[model samples]
Target chain A: MLDAHLRLSSLAHLGLAARSIEEAGDAGIALGEVPRRVALTLRGDGEDAAFLDAVGRALGTAPPLTANTVASLEDVVILWLGPDEWLVNAPAAREDALQALRSALGDLHHAVADVTESRTVLRLSGASARDLLAQGCSLDFHPSVFQPGMCAGSHLALTHVTIHQIAEDPVYEIHVHRSFADYLWRWLEAASEPYGLAVVTG
Target chain B: MLLITCPWCGVREEHEFACGGEAHIVRPLDSHTLDDAEWADYVFMRRNPKGVQYERWVHNDGCRRWFNMARHTVSHEILAIYKVGEPKPEFEG
Candidate 1:
């Protein structure tokens, strides 16, 4: 039997120790990995009241119907991927969230899948975080446009990433495919070189 | 780069979308009854208009929804954007 505890993050081989690093009095950006987050892809008719109600009961909030928006309650966050598709995220080892959704949605012509291993989450924060992301992304990063609570799926450095802005401090949680985790990490590090990059861990 | 507006996700970079060729190309209901040339025309033929052309595009990177767009082939200006099933809007070149 494979030990779940022995599972490692995609960036594990990089040996990036999470330590606070200060540079020239202040660091421009702080990068860290939020490993092992449970992700589930949920698909259902957004216009159906019963479907929405079931999902709401399961996660404590109805999935956001607006495009590129997010809804969260406690540790469960739901991102609208499309008109009828959503991505549900919760803390690590929260497999119960999936079961709760499956049971709640019982034969309601809906689909819920556990996609935890498909992608890894990385938290990028600090004042210069948006600037660093804007270097390669085409989306306008103006505060009024891409504010907290908003999320988008766009290409960053030619890699597809789903970015969720969780704070007014410009803290962003970037979700990228596990296979591209190393490449994105190296890219972020190189990009942050201009603005002192600090790699930290929780 | 073309700034295509996704009906659901708003405006995004053109790279995030994929051009799905000319729109409103309906498949023949009586395919088996049609001859070789007629079948080939249905499969291979597309209007290569120089002026306003209706085209299909999908926001593959963002919402992943297919939408219709009317564009000027010469100027590359988008005239109108509508959802999949909606009737195409009237447009002049």
Candidate 2:
């Protein structure tokens, strides 16, 4: 029996630790959870220079103004969710960044929300990652269109998700609600069965 | 399936959007002077036109932005898509 007081990731109950993961072999698809990351939903005027400057000072990188794009600095990534909304993601240890954002954006007409516990991220990568995602998503994932640094909000297997492509190797980080993490993971596993799914831990 | 284009998120599947009935229905300026019947008409009545129609749509799953759309009822053709607060484009047919 698992300890009741132990902290667990969203996918921890799926027993990924016991599953065999191919780290060196040529698995068609690799799946893993990016656990314990801080997610903040940020809203502000994209056209306001002061708002942009304040956020840039807080995160060391200005939020991407262009739709369906992402801006990254060191370990923090800001994904454009709308014309005036963005999702800021950073490591769990970077709570100082959150404080900096709140302090810097003071008196500005903006909203900052800590949504870390509300959502979980799944990393899907490898040669067959695009193909597997294409089966369930309507967005065009062709190499020319959805390259590195691009992000989009779409539904996969009927679950809402914000997908960010972080690497040219076609690695995609799917941000989904914590409650739907298991359902999406199972769906991905089923969808990648033909291509052979390899589960990894990070 | 209709391919609707979001003002901010570009083109996306129709399932990601929700139609909010007719657009450009202005409320009466003097609401206190209006009778119950007048208020009911403003709140309930919709054009429900048979030909070209202007309507509001929200990108529910994608960017969650609300915008306006012009579509033909019979042909199911989308004529134009514009952002909120923009002037409605003149359409003949």
Candidate 2 residue A160 C-alpha distance from true site, Å: 0.4
> DockQ score for model 2, please?
0.89
Q: What's the DockQ for every one of the candidates?
A: 0.88, 0.89
Per-residue lDDT of A52-127 in model 2, one digit per residue for the tens?
9999999999999999999999889999999999999999788777789999999999999888788899999989
Q: Ten consecutive residues with minimal summed lDDT in candidate 1 chain B? A: B84-93
TM-score of each: 0.95, 0.96
Residue A10 alpha-carbon offset, candidate 2, angstroms: 1.7
Location of the lowest summed lDDT over 10 successive residues in candidate 1 chain A: A16-25
Residue B66, model 1: Cα distance from true site in angstroms? 0.7
Model 1: how far residue A102 lies from native, Å? 1.3
The single-chain TM-score for chain B of candidate 2 is: 0.94
Q: What is the interface RMSD of each candidate, in Å?
A: 0.6, 0.6
Question: Candidate 1: where is the Cα deviation over 4 Å?
Answer: A1-6, A18-25
